[model samples]
Target: MATAKDVAARAGTSTAVVSYVFNNGPRGVAPETRERVLRAAAELSYRPNALARALSFGRTLSVGLIVPDIANRFFGELARALEEVAAERGNILLIGDSSQRVEREHEHIAAFVERRVDSVVVVSVSDDPDLSAFADAGIPVVALHPLSESVNASSISIDYRAAAASATRHLLEHGYRSIALFNGPTESAGSRQHRDGFMDAVRDLAPGAAVEEHSTQIARAHAAQVALDMLARPSRPRAVYCATDEQAYGVLFACHRLGLRVPDDVAVTGFDGTEHSAYSYPPLTTVRQPIPEMAERAIALLAAGEERVRETVDFTLAVRESCGRHGTDVAS
Candidate 1:
């Protein structure tokens, strides 16, 4: 059977347009586009049974999820956890990967709204995404990160600033003075929190510790490249605090290639504790945002139909071989 994506391809338009032509109304399709969609649907024998059911029951039974990069292990884990939880609730998850592009993010936003998914979960590329379309469509939304109070949506996220600070403090207690912060590429809400938290630790713990910051695309390869350049410098910091485990892996890779030992030469800590963190060359110390717990709460919040529910979850610092045998896990 032809799927909406198939019809979209045949029509030379987006799945959203096919949805608009089939579901009608949340938005209008241009006459030419509508003709193309109809012709494509008939030729492909496309039937939107889901849309029909949604209309009949007044609920889509599907939830839309938007993430910056689906391939990133953190987001990949998040998607999988969300899928499992949503499945238990009798709703399927429709995921859209924004490829870390604002325009691509916009496309997914429009597509989700047009398809009239019952609700949405966003791990947006932007710090402050435009939730107006979802708001106008009356679809409930829950952001996995903090959001401005002005936005008409709920948020469920770990306290990133505190998480970062805790990780940095752990590194300081390890007696590494000069530390570098490997942060996300953009200076958004997340990056700002990471920066502030890192500085907070430096100011209070190490006092005059040497610190520097570098930004990279949230990918291992990009992070490796950045790490190589930064670590190649003669005065490279003795320890590094990475915003994500993926980046920490890159730093580890750089250390290997540069003949630097893990804690002996350059200690490191990471955030977003994907399972891979435990098995890295030197097991990584990281701040773990509880994925399963977060997913359960997010799904329950959407199911409850609460207008706006802002919630925070605890993050655990997994002390492992990477930051020098801190063996105990700390939760906050």
Candidate 2:
């Protein structure tokens, strides 16, 4: 609870001198004076008022991050990476979990704009999220998903279509013709990209392949229930490609409940290769999204300025126990 005045009083200096010393300021303080102020601050355990400073400078020195689900491991890891990167660049990260609600996401947008965060990084619950709040407030934003060209915001993401193709091709090359796609609950731009990529792979590989598709919420529980119903069908897919690692885990659980063994019975591939994916009952075969790199680039773009950048990072197919290493020997 030590204030600048307390530190200044202890250091035998004016509050302005203390402020100058703390902020490294508009006016220079003598080295000896600075040393005394530092010693006094240390003695009193003084901390500068961040809000006051932000008010003075017209910047909060913070970035706002909005994700649909923070409980999901992918977003959790991304938030951690972005926090680290922001700290490295002398800024703080404010995380907002929309919990898959458009209203909640809009609430976060308004909140961040009201607080005057330097910039924002968004992974919207809806593909066509209204970013006009940030735009109207002149707050720069970068979306971490595939956004439509009409939205006035920067974006950075991997090619979901290509990544989807890679996962599907792995199954096809392994001779699993009856493949299925377990996609997100809604037909979003992101989901569409995934679907398009999946269909592209299936069609290119097998001229007349019949692929089944199912949609569910990204949560493991919802996906689990959905998978349980689907996998019980007599004509269930030979291999299933999931839109997310969370959904894949649900399918894995469903297979277990139905007394089915992975690869031997039903092959599974997941997208968003989060770290925990490797620790699944049978390590997952997935498309490894470059999370850390994506976080870094997104933060960098926001920090540098919002210049309407569109970028695609690389994605790799991580073949492991779940998908069964069939035709290819690649692993990660």
- 1-332: candidate 1 lDDT, tens digit per residue: 99989999988999888888887856899999999999999998888886565776699899899998898999999999999999998899999999988899899999999988999999887777888899899899999988878888999999999999999999999889999999987744488889989999999999889999998888888989999999999999999999988889999999999999998899999999998898998999999999999999998998989989878899999999888875988889
TM-score for each model: 0.84, 0.94
The residue-by-residue lDDT of candidate 2 on 23-123, one tens digit each, is: 88989999999999999999999999987887788888999999989999999999999999999988999999999888899899989988899999999
lDDT of 2: 0.88
User: Which consecutive 10 residues in model 2 have the weakest lDDT in total?
Assistant: 323-332
The candidate that wins on TM-score is 2
Q: On a 0 to 1 TM-score scale, where does candidate 2 land against the true structure?
A: 0.94
lDDT of 1: 0.90
Candidate lDDT (C-alpha), each: 0.90, 0.88
Quote the lDDT for 80 in model 2: 96
- Candidate RMSDs in Å, in order, are 9.4, 2.0
